[model samples]
Target chain A: MSETQQPRAEATVTLTNDVGLHARPAVRLTQTAAKFSSRIELALGNQSEWHDAKSVVKVMRLKAKQGSEVRFRAEGDDADAAIRSIVDLVERHFDG
Target chain B: MSDGTVAIGIVSHSPDVARGAAEMVRQMVGTSVDVGWTGGNADGGLGTDAAQILSVIEQIWTPAGVVMLVDLGGAEMNTEAAIEMLPADRQATVRIANAPIVEGAVTSGTMASTGADLEAVVAAAEEFGG
Candidate 1:
């Protein structure tokens, strides 16, 4: 038997920002992730380990450089919105 | 607007470092969280001054509490001394995180901006492990 799962969303976005996922971008990502109640996780490229999107320290430690692909996976009621925000933030170069 | 959030204090041996860290926090975390910083010796040299630290603590003191990040052992000691100088009641609300000054302040400020309490903010900073 298959168990029911909560709402989830996933997306992989390229880091187009000049600094990649450095301090400023990491801060923006974590702050955006915190706005949603969903549990959001981020991974670099094809890495198996996922870091909490709302954790600045963990997000920064990912060390995802420019042109790297960052995958976002969020689970919860607002998972879709969380993923959208993260993808948008990355696409916008984290300027917002 | 600053209510219900822990404040962040940055202490460094050089005044420039303290100011720059605080500025970075402000730029990254926005103005949602309060950030105060103090550095340099009493004579404007490169050292930590407990008196300066105490003033910044008092400036940013809130019921939510304040998390301090220090650059070196001297800064930590000075920050501790400054906290000790606070009234007994206020003293309990301040903490010195064992983390790098810039990273700790930024993390603490970001956590605090999310309405995190003192303990969580301190943990976020200390997670850097100096």
Candidate 2:
């Protein structure tokens, strides 16, 4: 889907907390992304696997497991801010 | 209560997990289910406020009794705490439980929606529980 879209950057945010990327954080990230219209992909640490951020099911299947760093990229008019917002959210443990 | 045994909702910090569990139940019971969730704040942990949980109960819970599957326990713990502070009436109508928030909710939701009785619902939950 990124084949034709606005500028996008892959920002990697490490899962610093003990909980890992568990369901709570994943749901928050997915919910936050649902607020915008864009193609969002979440990649697990150093893995080629990336799932659509909009689909809560697909993201959960990634099994982000704790301590897994996720690289998020948003493709859209507000891709930059969307990516930053998600990065900040992940950094914050979806609000701990 | 349930046209089946019980109605179950996975009240956790993660909406995806809740929805995932709901998805599983929908497949099992082959019907839609009532659902709710919260968990976005960093320090917020994985629990919604008791007030929010009540809102879900009022808004989503239906004829069959509902089983609340919370994640953690103790004072102020996520879903666990939320379930505790429920009023006498709400508590009477709902059953609070602990298990794999996702898998348990799905199984319970499916069984509950299918008109399974409380014992049968609890049994299904215990059958494939974490």
How accurate locally, in lDDT, is each candidate? 0.90, 0.62
TM-score for chain B of each model, two decimals: 0.94, 0.69
Task: State, as a TM-score between 0 and 1, how close model 2 is to the true structure.
Answer: 0.45
lDDT of 2 by residue, A1-96 (tens): 455648676688888767765555555665567666678898888888777775544565677766777888888877888888888787787782
Per-model chain A TM: 0.95, 0.85
After superposition, candidate 1 runs with Cα above 4 Å error: A1-4, B1-3
Which candidate ranks first by TM-score, i.e. highest? 1
Q: Model 1 fnat?
A: 0.54
lDDT of 2 by residue, B21-43 (tens): 66655554344456554433345
Clash pairs for candidate 1: none
DockQ of each: 0.70, 0.02
lDDT of 2 at A90: 78
Docking quality tier of model 2: incorrect
Tens digits of lDDT, candidate 1, A1-96: 998898999999989889999998998998899889999999989889888988899988888899999889999999999999889899899996
Root-mean-square deviation of every model: 2.1, 14.4
